[model samples]
Target: MDTSEFNHGHGGEPINWERAAGDNAFVFMKATQGTRYKDPWFAEDFAAASRTSLLRAPYHFFDPQSPYDAGAQARHFARTARAAGYTGQKPGELPPVLDIESALVNHRAACPPHTDARQVAALLRHIEAEFGVRPVVYTNHSFVTLCLAGDARILKGYQQWLPAYQSEPPRLPGTGRDWAFWQYTDRARVPGIPGPVDRSVYHGSLQELRSMAGIRGNPPER
Candidate 1:
C-alpha cells in the first residue's frame, strides 16, 4: 500500500495495522513533503506497522521546484523517516522511496513543468548516501518521458516503482530498466483499510523481495 495522511481509513478511523498485514505484503507511508512538511500520521502509522508482519517503508514527496535544493530535501526525508523508525537497514524494511511525480496541482498537465531531472538525480544520490541503500523511485510514465528524458543513465541504477492503472503489466521505461513495483489501482478494497487504498504488486517472488530488503534466508511460511 502507498499511503499518506489523506488515506486514513473511512470515517477518519485509524487504519487497522494488524488487519492490513493480513491483506498486504508491504506498506509505504508518506513521511515528508519538500523540505518542511512532514506527514503527521507517519510516526503513529509506522510504529504500528512495525509490530505487524508487513514490510515497512517510508517515502518522500519531492518538490522538484523547491528552492531548498535536492540535498536539503533528502536530509529532511531521511531525518523524518529515521525519527519515524524507518532506517532502511532494519530487517524486513525496504529502502526509502522517492516519490517524484507532478505536483498535486499539476496532475493533469500535459507535462509537469516543475519536475527537474538533474535535481531528481541529485536527490537520489543524497538519499543513497544518507540511507546506505539505493532508494526506490516512485514515478509514472509521463513524468519519465517528459521530465526525466535526458537522465536515463542516472536513473537506471535505482529501482523504479511505477503507477499504471491497467490490467496489463506496465510498459518498461525507456531507461532500459525493469520496474521493481507496479501500482495497478488506487481504488483497491482491502479488508482492514476502509474506503479505497492504493495497491501495488512487487515484480519478483517473495524470496527475491526479501533479498532486496536485505533479509537472509527464505521468507517465513505464511
Candidate 2:
C-alpha cells in the first residue's frame, strides 16, 4: 500500500540480467517527465537496463496537446530511444509508453478531462506500425477514470502501468485485461540513486513477461 514511495536509482548500477530475472519486474525511471531526458546518460541507462531479464520500457509525458499529433510524440520517442543506443531487441525488447499528465489535453477536458480514445488508439496503432512494437499506457487512477473510464475496448489491449499512491493499485476486476505490472510504491531505496526510487511488480510470470518482450524462447518460472 506504500504506493507513492517508489524506489532509488540515480548514478550507475551494474545490472545483472540474471539477477534481475527475479520478481523485480521493471522500473521506469521516467526521464522525460523531468528535464532528465535531455541528458544522454538517461537514454544509455535505459538501453543498458533493457538488456536485463527484467523488461524495461521508456515513456514520454504528454502535456496538453490534441490527440491528433500525439502519435508523432510517440514516434519521436521510438527514434530517440533507439538512436540513443539503448540496448534491446529492437522494437520488442523495449516498449515506448505514453504518459498522459494533467495538461495533456488542450487546456483541460473538464474537472476530469476526457480524452478521445479513438484518436489515442490511432496514435498507438501508428506507433506500432512505425516502430514494430506496441506502446504501453501510464496513468494515475484519477486521470484514468476521467479519460479512459468508458474506453474499455482499447484499454483492455494495452499494458497499464498504474500509479496508485499510498494504496495497492486496483487489479483487473471482471475486466479480462490484467495489469502487466503495478508501481506499488516509490522511494524503495533501490541501490544506485542519491535518494530513494520507485519500484513495481509484473502481474504475470517472468517468462510471460519475456514473451511479451519477444524473447523468442520461453524463460523459466521465477
What TM-score does model 1 achieve against the real structure? Answer: 0.91
Provide the RMSD of all predictions against the true structure, rounded to 1 decimal: 2.1, 5.5
**Candidate 1 residue-wise lDDT, 44-102, digit = tens:** 99999899988879999887555348999999999998998788998889989998775
Off by over 4 Å in 1: 65-68, 104-107, 110-114, 169-173
Please give each candidate's TM-score.
0.91, 0.69
What is the per-residue lDDT of model 2 for residues 1-222, given as tens digits with 9 covering 90 to 100? 111112223344444334443545555544443212343445655655656655666666554245365565556665666666643355335566666543434665442232555655666676677656667777654554465663345656778777655776774332356566677666555433435556677777766776776666766455
Backbone clashes in candidate 2 total 20
- CA lDDT, every model vs. true structure: 0.81, 0.55
